[model samples]
Target: MSAIRHALTTKRADDFSAWYQEVISAADMAEESGVRGCMVIKPWGYGIWERIQRLMDDRIKAAGVQNCYFPIFIPLKNFEREASHVDGFAKEMAVVTHHRLIADGKGGLIPDPEAKLEEPLVVRPTSETIIGDAMARWIQSWRDLPLLTNQWANVVRWEMRTRMFLRTSEFLWQEGHTAHATREDALEETHRALEMYRACAEDDLALPVIAGEKPENERFPGAVETWSIEAMMQDGKALQAGTSHYLGTNFAHAAGIQYQDKEGGQQFCHTTSWGVSTRLIGGVIMTHGDDDGLRVPPRIAPHQVVIIPMLRETPEDEALLDYCEDLRKLVAAQAALGEPVRVLLDKKPGKAAAKRWDWVRKGAPLIVEVGPRDMAEGNVAVLRRDRLWNQDNGKPAFSFVSREDFSAQAPALLEAIQQALYDEARERRDANVTRGVTSMDQVAAHFADNHARPGWVEVQWSKPTSAALEAATEQLKALKLTIRNVPRDAEPADGTCIFTGAPATERILVARAY
Candidate 1:
């Protein structure tokens, strides 16, 4: 037990990255896999993911998006239909060159030389091609214009480097594909999906995010426009939490998706796609986590409250255990009475304090410890994770409330914690964001110094040509800065291009992204 306890880091301030790995591993959330760029999420971690899926799934269904499935393989011809899309994902595709393999008879395997496919199949990096092909076959009239469908599946992208929940080679996600009769309808769907992403991120996950359109260069391939929700992590870096794209009939035109209108005129169907992935787990970990461990919001925590039994080898211990059993029954009853809370009683022995620490590290919002002292007094010791410095010294800070009266207070306390986490994250986001007039040189300086202020800097480009934009992008890359977006409402500034001193237009957000 000491070895296990020592294996985990104690100070989040000393080494955040190390602490993160410790917390994730100690909580039995995930484990490194033999496969490069892959991880095995333990039951505890999968429970959290399931909770997220439940909430988001309900919301998506309520928004009139029907769930569906599509084939994971796309023929090479289908992939090349949209040149831009192919170009964007060509480097990362995992191609299936053969359909069969046979034994070599020497304790080895060999690809069957005669089992060549007519055309290579590419494991989908995204489902746009296959979904578009199906849409083309199903739609023949304007009445079938607005097709909304969603799929929960795994996608593979051969990444250079991978983090467990952040950027694995294979990850689970929900992607929405919609078709509309006109560009206006497609654009509306894009914005609506963005709003839903924000709502789920902010309200359900308790993470504050900024929503805006991506710059032309950063937009999705084959998309007229792309928008995203950018979340600021605790380490002062930005995470692209989710994205929604407005295709403007690009895919439809490429895949021959056409519909006849009321006037007997045939037109291509406008299209949109949006998705949020497991990367959200990483966002939540970084957003609300502290030095102790993860501090998950009650709204999404798999278990909102944990009860730790402080046992001993005595009659008093037996009495306390009995009391704990009673208390568990009481809490369970309250939960069954429409309390919207899930509680667990941990009865492991050895070190009660250490067990409490473990639960706190797991981000359980409320912890209750039953001991002989409390049993003698006919009460229980309650610990609140959200309250800062509950005691004067600020060491192991918490109030010891009576078990009998806890049900009345626990619900409100959990709600307050949920709200406070959001408020705190919002404040940090506002404080870190910096805005001002500047040149490309100044933008470089700000990012290099680790000053997030200039959350987004306002600069004018003398000439907004592709070459000029490329030069600006190169400069930013050198300085470790990337353009987040080019505001749609940007007006001509009274200055030259920040990089080339050419005539410039509106302000844009330039930051280092994850």
Candidate 2:
């Protein structure tokens, strides 16, 4: 096992991309599948996803959104109804040509020549088309407006590059589709959904994110306006954590969804769609993980605390086990009271310290070790992953706490850990953003020298014309990045443009994003 482990190589400091793959695989979270761009999320990884689902599902329910199911295969014509929507997804769709297969003489199955679909079905990259069709049939009057529904399902989008949870061909997510009588209501829904995503990312996932609108180039294909929550990873690259799109009446018009107003006037319904996918798992890993491995937030960690029995062949092994078991029961009882504590006793035969390290690599927030020494003294050794050991102070990585009183104190410790992680991520984000640039030279210099910040430069793109902005966008693209947002409060500046020094009005966030 040691030999096999030694063969594995990961670039901890120099190659963050490789390090991510190594840590993910080493922790047994997921594995690459036989199918390109797909992954097999292992039990441990799926456990995290399940926790995310439980939390987000509750939020969706509270927001007056009803859960519903839509078919995985959408008719080709339904997709084309919304031109921009189709254009965005056209390149990524996987179409089904034949419906049946038969065994050939050589024993391999072959597509039956007689079984061609009348209208080739496209595996849904997203469900907006089919959902809009449903709304068209179900909505006829103003009373039926604001039809809010959410679907938790898998979507397939073929991609050239893939990561375990970040970018995959198929992944699980919840997409919300709503139709409102007026544009204002639809806009409200979009912001509300974006706010929910922000809360989930910060409060639940413990990752701080900036909530704002996407630049024109990065907006969702069919959306009139798109908003997103962006979080910076440990490596300084931005992650588009979640998105909410105000689709206007585009889909309603395309799908023929019209509602009668109070005055008996027919009008197209305004629509909104928003989603957060398993890519959040990637966000959590990048935001909190260290060189050791993944550091999941205590709230979302599958195993929040682990108890290890520091037993040896000395006559006290049995006593240590008993003490550890008792501690586990105490913690479990506290968890039953809604404190969200999860504990595991490591009874495997081996070096107890090594077992503790194993749990640390798995990102358990807390570890408790019981031995004859500690058991005899009515205490257990406690160690926290969040608290770094101070060599200057001569502090050991582990400390001692009374086993009887641990349950009462554990909750506070976990809360401290949660706060510390959030603060650290916030600090990183603050340090990364750059601000107050008035020239194109400043933008170019910042991008070349510091990717982390000046975090975002507030610049006036003097020429707000589409052609000039597009030209600047092309230049930024060469740097492998783009603008993130246009500030709502941007004012026209008399100064020269940042890129061309022409006359400029708005400030935009520019960054290389995932």
Candidate 3:
């Protein structure tokens, strides 16, 4: 009967891209630095990253991977060692040719010509080449095989077109590099990392993903096989959330990572690398964010529950503060999703209603508001971000419960919100995917409307190679689509290829991507 007033000025239905930018700004997440294609992550934004780092680090460590630090500056020659690897990143690599800056005649600083280095150093884009060099020296015998190492660091890539966390010129990520004695071992590690990413995305971040092997064209340049977890955004575009690459003996051969076998024979190592980055934060935003803003999953939310005491700046305010503080302690002690609940009590100088809306935009999983009257009545108002609106009344769906009961139910409440968000996203993704598309023309017709939210299509293909593959890619390009991946769990193809009309060997998902 009444229209609900959304917190964000840009509605998602009106424009998803604009709405995404608005969420980042209104939620105080991050902003552009003066520098082009870079962002300054604010407290709230960095806080979310910290939570992701902690949880993902735990999984990394659990896989028997030792953490290590690598230099941010890598020798250009190291990249030159692997031609394909170097070519893949050459355009985006930021090179350092001069050691120092000097004053120009115009009173501005410029690179000193006299301080040029013998060889340019590249800002680390990905560390396989450099890390492979280390493996060559550290691994001497078969006993040293299966060397698993990971590093958490920032990397630079000169992205021409950029978006905040999605395509920044500089971003933070963890790269896992391992050297194995055999191809089977390396491939096993590759799949292990893929499963880890799927679990992390689905369980930790509440993102349901399709884990599959990428086509030859989409494989990491030097990789024999590359795998990725593809997630569907609310707008029906695909986000390659994370990737794991099986490099065969490519880098090992280039870097001379040889180990002596039991028979005293030297052999090249098979290597695998997998990584997930801050772009995952972007995926979470697109996957779970709504018109109001982000509804962070409880497991990854910096503060799962935020408590705001409705203070009036009067004598009664002190009593309300004490009541809210007590409530905060109670909620923090309760365990949710295998950890103590994270709760914050806001006692800042502001009206409670304003603060409540601020937290709503930030998508705090639960917001508990207590007023003097509520304290007198021994009750508190709880708002769940996942269920923000009441359809019948067009108002916030706030539930009033007694203080003792609210604290007792906090853990289940947070867990429920987490599951609800994941289910909602999963359902939407499942519904939007168009299957039974048997021809290229059908695929073209399905995505004809640029304004409509056109999702993905799962079509059968002949698994073309070399020239044929290139032709298939060009055909898809003409339709403004690309193959996302061949899902690991897809049904065996019993039809003809959509492109060449050959007997289909596999099924691939085609979609527009970020």
Candidate 4:
């Protein structure tokens, strides 16, 4: 057996949580940072995020939101202006108290007791509070009503538990904050942003997702409505990939974001905020990755193709390295979906198998090995990352294609891999989704079943009475499941809530999510 074949020790089906960390280690995407709850994203991981950021930024700009920045710290008073927002993020906030540090007599530096600040600053968990304050100052009249802005920045949430790329004390993200004169415009902007998220997830990342509004309990703090894109992972857990919030006048009123109307009347502006963070990297990991190793969607892969020169440079075989180099240039020059195909030439000295699986573990979309025989045959051996396991035995299974044909179709081939991953994931999700659960027993059975992937279960939700909603909330919480969303255009259902016998509306998706 190849050592590289055993790169990941835990099978995803057997122990998903352990396999996730193992995949990250084998892939060398990230590592735990010196800070207890933070993580350091390695270059390969950051490269993927850089792709995500660039694509997302273009879409955001198209939506008329300009890129900008906000202070990382919020005055404690600013955070307290919105009571619900403060309550929601209070436990996770990191407060800064002192202004300076002083050398102690013993030689260690300590926070200067005399340098205490009059008002403590809270490291922003999200920029709504801080950005809201800025929005108020920036918008004083009707002409300034639609204040659309986005910021790419890091935030400190101080989460108790941590996972690489998923949840941590600090992470990189792009947050968009906008203000509109009319509620309709704000809502429209919110939905538009949500649609953009859906496109980026399904089309660009090749991950199928359901775009919907979050339930009240799961809504962003202080927002009137919250929209999300949720993707099901291979382990049957749903990952909330991105979110857009319709904040109404909550933040505007709280921050005094008043704009004078054409009629000389002053009114609060409606607001919206949406964001996707490094957590989407986690989504990519669990969605497309297999037990052998990570399999990045071709579009987001750092290096779509890596070429290894399998060399034994006798006078007859001396041309093999030259052939590999020619092939690399041929592949890179071809465009894939308007972007130059990213290709790498792996010339590092080592066991060829070890070198080959390193690229496999890192999830490069394609691996081509060029040798003396291949050079003479005018062909290249290809091992597609997605089809790495489609072999009769442990022996390396590589399919050969003529050099001319491979070079010409490289772009389309990447597209095919991207499509294949999406199709497979969608099939799994569709297969496991159990709809119209008419009873609590059925709901319990669906969630408790460990035999197959429990992608999603749809239940008709009651038109929320406080007592009944609370009961259902507590029940679902006990079962370790939560409603992913109540889709905006979900078809109405005539059934009753599975948790309670109360009359219900449309279906809301429920599952255990990341």
Q: Tens-digit lDDT track for model 1 on 1-514?
A: 1112232455655665677777787777889999988889887678788878888888889889999999889888898899999899999988988878999999888888889888999988899999999999989999886999999999999999888888998898999999999999999999999999989999888898878777777889999999998888776777889899999888998899999999999999999999999899888887888766778888778777788878776667777777888877776666421246788878777688888877777778888877777777877777777653334444555567778788667777788888999999999887876666466656767766644243545555543547766877888888777777654445546666677765666556667677
Q: Quote the lDDT for 242 in model 1.
A: 89
lDDT of 4 by residue, 1-514 (tens): 4433555679887889899998898999999889888888898889999988988898999877899988998899987788889889998989999999999989899999999989999988999988988898999999996999999999999888888888888999999999999999999999999999999999888888999988787888899999999999987889999999999999999999999999999999999999999999999999888877888887888889999888544465447767888898899899997799999988776666788888888888898988778888999999888888644566556889988889898899899999999999898878877787887778788778775677788889775756767778788888788889987667887888677677777689888888
Listed in order, each prediction's TM-score against the native is 0.90, 0.92, 0.99, 0.96
Q: Which candidate ranks first by TM-score, i.e. highest?
A: 3
Query: Cα miss at 435, model 3 (Å)?
Result: 1.2
Sort order, lDDT high to low: 3, 4, 2, 1
Whole-model lDDT, candidate 2? 0.82
Please give, for residues 138-233, the per-residue lDDT of candidate 2 as tens digits.
Answer: 999999978999999999998878888999999999999999998999999999999999999998888888787776667798899999888888
Clashes of 3: 0
Q: Which sections of candidate 3 miss by over 4 Å?
A: 449-451
Error of 3 at 491 (Å): 1.0
lDDT of 1 at 113: 80
- Model 4 weakest 10-residue run by lDDT: 311-320
Candidate 3 structure quality by residue, lDDT tens digits, 12-60: 8998999999999988999989998999999888999999999999999
Best by lDDT: 3
| Higher-scoring candidate on TM-score, 1 or 2 | 2
Positional deviation of residue 478's Cα in model 3 after best superposition, in angstroms: 0.8
